[model samples]
Target chain A: MTNETASAYPGVSALVHKHLPKVPFTADKTLTDANITVEPAHFLELMQGLKERRELAFDYLRNVVGIDMQDEGLVCKYQLHSMKHRHSIQVTVHTPPGNPHIPSLTGLYAAADWHEREAAEMLGLVFDGHPNLKNLLLDEDVRIHPLLKAHPLQKMEIAQGIEDRDPGFKF
Target chain B: MTVWPEERLVTADAFNTVDMTINVGPQHPATHGVFRMVLTVDGEMVVDCEPYIGYLHRGLEKLTENHDYRQSMGWWDRTDYLAGMACEMAYCMAVEKLGQFEVPERAEYIRVMMVELSRILSHLMFFGAFGADVGSFGTSFIYAWRERERIYDFFEEVSGDRMFPTYFRPGGVQMDLPENYEDRVRWLLGSIRQGLEDFDGLLTGNEIFVERCRGLSPVSQEQAVDWGLGGACLRSTGLAYDIRKVEPYSVYDRLKFDIPVGKTGDVFDRFIVRMAEAWQSTKIIEQCLDQMPKGLVLNPDLPKTLRIDSGECYIRTEGTKGEYGVYAMAKGGNKPYRMKLRSPSFCNLSALKQMVVGHYVADAIIILGSLDIVLGEVDK
Candidate 1:
């Protein structure tokens, strides 16, 4: 971990790699300076550790999002920031096609509870160990996560085509 | 603070009290939107609570995947309906970051003024709702919205729409501040000050209002820090962390205002912090107007459609509630590979479980009100 090459961008990404090892952590050229990507397993450890540390405390759990990676399935991302350092980092864990599960970070950051639940219901990622995991943004009667690529909209019969529905029927 | 030892004091058979689960929204005005809360209660004490959202979720995330970046501006308005401008700012910042575009100085100043105005507006709604929660009745609620109407007038003049002001874009604002904007804003600011002073006498000093909120729903400094509460919610806990000062996005660093703090981490403190913040926001707008640069609003060099080629960026700012952040990933395309919003209400609402666990059932609504959540932001 310590033997890896140092990050060239010594601003936000510097603090990021400084705390985590070089196993799956890698940087991609993005808008601001750099976009640091880490493995899901390593991400959980890095974030949990970041929450505990005093000097490098990434105390604020800023945002959680679920993104469809097309062929790669869904990638659940967490954007974490530090109130003290004025820096930010993006951590992502990929869920496999169809069924997906990741260890919940609600234990570490309580904010992750609803986010994980939303992601679970929206993109179909099972957040194991979430104290009260349930469908947040969708009804049980309405099946399928609309955000998922594999979920067939036509088959679900939720959103009818413009041609299929008669508006004037008023039923 | 009594720290109970880690032990199960009540067994399943010993529990004679069963919590009555009450579903409180998807229709109730207090739920704030098409959202519902499942409150499990024994008499007036709440045993458990769960928030149900997505009644208004129109699959905007999926819709964005089909539309261009410019079209996505409309969705930001729907996310945080009250603080639409802040959402627009965050979205614009993310797009600007992704495209490596810059907004003109005049645009930046106008943007700052607009966001500050929106911040005041959101806080007004918070104060009104919080007052309503505690039976303060139409007095604070009416006064807050009445003052908010002036700001909406300014919004209507600037952008054709009053509520959903989709007045921001990647390169800059949708357009410059309207003609005679300085006069209107100045008048609005003066009106807000007078309204605030009247509000002070009518609601702030009222004995009943103060007593209901002073110590109820108290949050310790460590608890606030641990829970990741921000904006006025965090300030009520005695921490003076304002992203405008700390991170200093846009032209905020150029301006000056004190980030108000409270000594006591209670509902009263939260109210006090927000009231002071409305004044601070007014001060910010005054400064922006005084020294607002005269130039183009949008960056002339940027192209029509944002083509963010192979990059990702997370741009954030202190919205009315807290840290409103946007994460954008572009893979050499016009449309974003993925766009994610890290909403403030979502983070603020996270503290509800801890805050209400030990308090009475009535305090649950007060705590939720103190958190100042917008369901659109929460569900997003």
Candidate 2:
């Protein structure tokens, strides 16, 4: 990275450095701007700090993206912005192989309710404390995570279920 | 002895009054496009609301992940269908920032002009629809439609399509403005200003419309921020936060325009904030047209296929609705690994339950209308 590019997100990096020294998060530069990876165990603590800290008040939960890494595990990415300070950060939590569970942020940020549901339904990453984690944009009865790498793009072949037939969408 | 029904009270469980659940829209006009909500009402007042979105979901992120960067442009425009060019600008800015490409100065100015026009277009839609919500019926819709049709004709003259023009590319625009485009746009601006004046006389000047919206659903600034409301919703809380003024992307830093804010953050404040913003957008367009340089519209050094070795970033723009943000991750490929949109309507719509729980059923409809959510953006 160039000097200019590396120095862009100083607020995020500085906030992470000053507040969370022992939380097992490294300020990885190669990832997206303000990328911080934490274990599922320390995820809630770190996230609560990020939202509650006065100087680094990351209040608004923007988007939640869930990814399936196949061999590694399932991962959830959270984009947060502070309306007060106008700084942004991305928090990445990687779950274990068999256990794809992470604590939900619906309590901390009310905006996380729908976003967490979308992430859960898309990639099958289970949010632990979410009140409603049922299908959001997909069929209410359909039980599948189509955005996973293993799921094929809909082709000429008919997929598994009966409700998978068309879904009656209008323009 | 005679007893009055108004003073009569039932003890414990005699002749119990049950809470009734009513479903509004998936087809109804009041709920806007394809959105459904189940309202649990106790008599006339709503006690709970469960919003069911996704009727308009097209899996935009999944499709964008599979296609090349340029191929995803058409799909993003459909997200905020009312403001296609605004969505285009956000998508292109994300791609350009990811690839570290340079956009020409002339292209920047043109992009701003088109986006501000889109802002006006979307705000006009709110005025028309919100007026219909508050019982103006066909009058306000027709008044707003007149100006929209003129703007659409101008857009067709430039891009050959009325909606979803897909006119923006990674580095800049698909093409330059046509001959005498300035004269035509200036005429359109005159027409837009006239339309605004008529709307002001019709709705804002009317006593009933202001009376209906003045004190409905008043929101505190802290509550608005916590609920993640954006665009007019946030500004209506008397907070002077606008992405254009706060985080000056593109050529907005060079231009000057005031951020219109509300005093009480009620339904009336939300309505007027957008109305005042329409005037500011006009000012922005005038400045952009005057200062635009004469040069190439597209970058000369762009690659045939955009490929980032490995880079990712979040690009945000002040979309007509709010902070329309795109988070793009490209890891050594032409296709994006993950592309997520933080749509303003989706975040703003999530606050419906909190906003609608205590109001009367009729007032609840007006409150939802005041939110002005596009289902396309919400479901995406």
Candidate 3:
């Protein structure tokens, strides 16, 4: 983790550092927001502290993005904003190569319902406590994760078994 | 009247009312696009609403991931089809941030002006559509089209296309504004003010419209923030959290504008807030015209084929509908490693079930209309 990136809200990082000393956070060089990487085991606990702690007060769940990190594993990235402090942070959670289970934020933030579903369907990350873990932007019965790096763009038809013929190129 | 048999006589309690399910639009006009919702109605009141989207799902993110940085601009504009320029601004800003490119002063002003115009265009569409939803039908739509057509004409003069004007490049705009663009936009603004007054008198002053929308589906600030509502929807809840004002990206900090807020955050508040916001957008455009410099629109130093060594950034802009945020990441490639759109319409639409339940079936439709969701943005 690099300390070179300056935070837009220095107070936010200071507050986090003071409160949760164990949780390591790095300032994102490209963006102003602070970025934290947490394991699936401590993900819920860290998120709860980020929300419940009055100083942190990350009330808004801005976005959830699922990335297929190829050999590393599947990653779920969350952007959270504190409406009170007007500060935002990005949380990255990595799951094991085969085990893509992350605790759901639906119980904590109401906005997580659809975001979790979208992430779940797009990258095949299982949100453990998500009430409805169905496909959002994809078909209900379509079980393929389209956003994975392994999933070829042009060969979607062939992959889905819609066409028997082989399209030549592969990404 | 002849008396019926005692056993045949019906009592209110004796009637068995099974909740009827009403499926509205994957094709219907009222849905605004290809969005469908199944409402479980116990009589007139909606017990539950299950909104099913993705009908217009084009795998925008997946497509962006596969394509080069510049190649994905067209798709981003299509995400918010109504305000294509606004979406383009967000997309360009994201790419620019990832590459750490500097836009020219004149270009920034031009970009702001176009985005504000797009905002008005989008809000005007909402005005017309919401009026139609409230039973005014074609009258309001035609009123909206009058101004929209003029704006589109201006847009066409500036850019080649009317709707998806891919006018914005990563570092700046495609080109400078047309020579007579200033005079034309000034006249357009005057006409827009008149159009706004027409809407105000037609809808805002109408007693029936007010009665229908007032006190319907009131959302608190907490609810708005919790459910991830943005733009007019969140502002109507009285939070005054406009990204343009709060974050002040591009030239927004240099310009001056007011963030309109509602008292109760009800359906009427949402409508009125958007009306006021449209007026505010006009103010912004006027300022941009005044402050614009004379220089190159596109940065000269930008590479022909844009490539980033390694970086990640989440760029948030005040979209016409809400907070249009783009999360971009590049790891030593010409194509972005991952590009995720934190689209406001999608978030606003997610809370539909919570807001619709307990409202009358007709009111439920009104509530959905209040959200002002573009299905393109929602299902991106």
Candidate 4:
């Protein structure tokens, strides 16, 4: 953390803006905690810079979550925290409808391995370079994406013994 | 000296060893819960290990998505069953953050007290189970149980349940503390301190136990961060980065306590760190008791049902295991659109294959025990 950054401890989003001038991302200021977007193509380059750069060294990858955005796409969120500076930020990357492939962070952060596996199994988002992205919390052979908005909660494919290709469910 | 031909050397008999695959248990005792691992050993030294979890998976995230905001509290309590109250605090904090609800000052202090108590409860379990893992038999477990039962009795008085006390609410707590809570908690603190001394004498001070665990599976600070280990596992690597201290939530910022760290990041360091942490938790609870105010425990201004319009936030707490975090996104409804739990056990357990590969098979169990994973949280 620099002198100006240390003095202004909570201006993490400002520091992020200063560091990545070329990348196009927005910061949320209401909670003073921001959500920055990353293009699928430039995700790895930006993440590498964030981890290696001293001012924005988000070395700790706290959590990764996969969210289904219906018509928009599937979203992969990376929650990063810097132990040195004691600041944190969330980075979101979106992939379109059937093209749910995002670059994997397993190589950068070993913590991303199981998290990516869980997200891939639950939301049907494919991690491009994940070494062993298999089903984590679900049955290994079951081909089901349970967390999608379109998936029925009450009548999941695994719940009832009857293996219907489609079941009637209304929310 | 007897001389032999060069050809004789080739026909000489030699000792041979085969790599044997051993299954440790989706049901065995040392596993702590329904966790299974396959260890391939080459003459007592483990060459490879593969851990299989999710035997206890209950689809917590999917279940949380389906239920109403308030109704979902019970399920999170089951995630880290050893420290259910701590889990409740994290869940409630996320909900409160999303809806912009105000928790009372008195409730904040009470919540801190309960969470700290849960921390101690969880740590005591580690001391007991880890001791058994390193070979102290049933004595330490019984010693831990005595203090745990007393704490559970107190929890029963407060929340009417021993293990899964769903006592926390979104804005505050489910109810006020009993009239004699401070006095009772103070008495319980004395017993806990005494219990700690016993564990110190029994396990930490034991020469055999120390020798067995001292330098086993040492992890560097860089390796630990990359592996995403947290709580005592991360602190043992000598980083003073605790969510309570670094990123203060609830009343942790107001209360003063030191984050204990270890220099070597060894198995013994992890054990000693949690022991010291239990002592710190006692201090936090005492502080909370002294400074706590008297007011409504639950927020009186909340409506019959909560309906969040739009919000997104990740609430992280220093849970008994590690950073028990909840990432909640409320698109607009009485229920959250999605709530994902970043459970520490799941992350820590993922690094097991790296930690256990080169050690003796027996030491692998000890290392796994030191990680102190609650499979409920891991499989969720």
Model 4: which docking level applies? Answer: acceptable
Per-residue error at B126 for model 1, in Å?
2.0
lDDT of 1 at B51: 66
Show model 2 residue runs off by greater than 4 Å. Answer: A1-6, A30-32, A155-157, A161-171, B1-15
Off by over 4 Å in 1: A1-8, A11-24, A27-29, A32-35, A94-99, A141-143, A150-171, B1-18
Please give the lDDT score for candidate 1. 0.77
* Docking class of predicted structure 3: medium
Residue pairs with colliding backbones in model 4 are none
- The lDDT per prediction is 0.77, 0.86, 0.90, 0.88
Better of 1 and 3 by DockQ: 3
- Candidate 1 CAPRI-style tier: acceptable
The lDDT leader among the candidates is 3
Best by TM-score: 3
lDDT of 1 by residue, A51-98 (tens): 776656777776777877878867877766676765555566776776
Candidate 4 residue-wise lDDT at B369: 96
Worst 10 residues of 1 chain A by lDDT: A1-10
Cand. 1 TM to true fold: 0.88
Over B242-321, each residue of candidate 1 has an lDDT whose tens digit, in order, gives: 87876678898789899999987898898889899999999999999999978899888987776777767667789899
Each prediction's RMSD to truth: 6.9, 3.6, 2.7, 3.2
| TM-score, B chain alone, candidates in order | 0.93, 0.97, 0.98, 0.97
Off by over 4 Å in 4: A1-10, A29-32, A155-166, A169-171, B1-16
The residue-by-residue lDDT of candidate 3 on B201-296, one tens digit each, is 999999999999999999999998999999899999889898887777888888889999999999999999999999999999999989988999
